[model samples]
Target: MSARPRSKTRATWLTLLGGTFGLHRFWRHGLRDAWGWLHLLATLTGLAGLQRLDAFGIDDAQAAWMLPLGGLSFAAAMLATILTGLTPDERWDAQHNAGRSGGTPPSGWGAVLAVIAALLIGTTVLMSSIAFGLQRWFEAQAEADLQTPQRISVPR
Candidate 1:
């Protein structure tokens, strides 16, 4: 096997920061998408909508938060794809590989995985804290109820 030629120095960091603008997409393999960038923009901006959705009986807070987070990750991935270029199919020989390859594709999916793991851990911490607070509240209520007993009188 021949040595892999180096593409331009990794611009992934730029792609990551400028994902909302889709700057990464342009440099990776000469690709572009305005709508996907729009989605990223929406994910970045529509965070308030997620909270209001809760008032409309969408009580699944985790899902509510996660959807937007996942959307952001998806947008980031799109940006990453734009920035990283799609993976090269492995059928070509050295010359074709040289033509087709665009440096090592930044692992957009891997980045998404890391984001998900961090979010999950954060969610768990928040949920446990809430649960602990609720448990304490109920315990306090039970104590109050025990201390304040109903009285009964003898009946004739």
Candidate 2:
């Protein structure tokens, strides 16, 4: 550890702004953190999903699967932001800034605002993803129904 005090507000803001890239993880746990790398990979995969959607369009099966990856990644990042913001100052300092020169600082409005923003953005992304997935599923079911032949009963 660098022995430098970590600010809860900064961590919260980082999670809100760069959680998709694992910036907050890297800030807290350094470059060797596996979770941080996973975050980066997930974000990249999500970007790939976005590109696939752009090229193939919404109707494409692959796009349907791929696009949600990005949305889910972003929403997960927002959740992380909310969690980071809500963490108590004492616990946060003990975990992140133990034995540091300065003691824990009180979390201010910045963290609260970040949490609020995360909630709004995360909810929107999650709900939109669910809607998109359901719409695609329903469309596929309708198509399958149309393709299947219905048996006719003869009246004697």
Candidate 3:
């Protein structure tokens, strides 16, 4: 690890802005972190899902399933941002900046702003994903009902 102290503010901002790509994880754990690679893979998958949706349109069956991967990945990243921002400075310094000369300086307003933004964005993404999935499911069910042949009853 480098002798430089890890700034909580920078970590919080990275989590907010690039957590889906695992930038925050890379910052904390260095390049070899497996989780960082996983984050990159998942983010790429999510982007592919978006491309599929754009190419096939929302009604496409594959797109319907694929789009949620992006939203969920984003929501999880926002949650991580919130958690990182909310951690106490002392604890953050001890855990991430240990052996550094001065330890991490106070995060101040930057961490607070990151937490607020993450909460707003995360909640919106999560709710929208749920609503979109449910709407698609119901539409599919309705379409199926309409396509099915109805049975006629005769007087017995």
Best candidate (score: TM-score): 2
Worst 10 residues of 2 by lDDT: 62-71
Residues 1-156 of candidate 3 have per-residue lDDT tens digits of: 568888899999999999989898898889999987887886787778778878988888876766676778788899999999999999998798778876567999999999999999999998987887788899999999999999999999
lDDT of 1 by residue, 1-156 (tens): 454643322343444455445555554434566655564565554444455555554444343444455355444444443434333323222323465434444344554543454445445544554564455467667878999978999999
Candidates 1 and 3, the one with greater lDDT: 3
**64 Cα displacement, candidate 3 (Å):** 1.0
Candidate 1 off by > 4 Å: 1-7, 26-32, 50-66, 69-156
> lDDT scores for all predictions?
0.47, 0.87, 0.87
Candidate achieving higher TM-score, 1 or 2: 2
lDDT by residue (39-130, candidate 2, tens digit) is 88877877787787788787888777666766787898999999999998888887888788867669989999999999999999989878
For every model in order, what is the number of clashing pairs? 3, 0, 0
Cα lDDT, model 2, residue 69: 68
Judged by lDDT against the true structure, how good is candidate 3?
0.87
By summed lDDT, the worst window of 10 consecutive residues in model 3 runs over 62-71
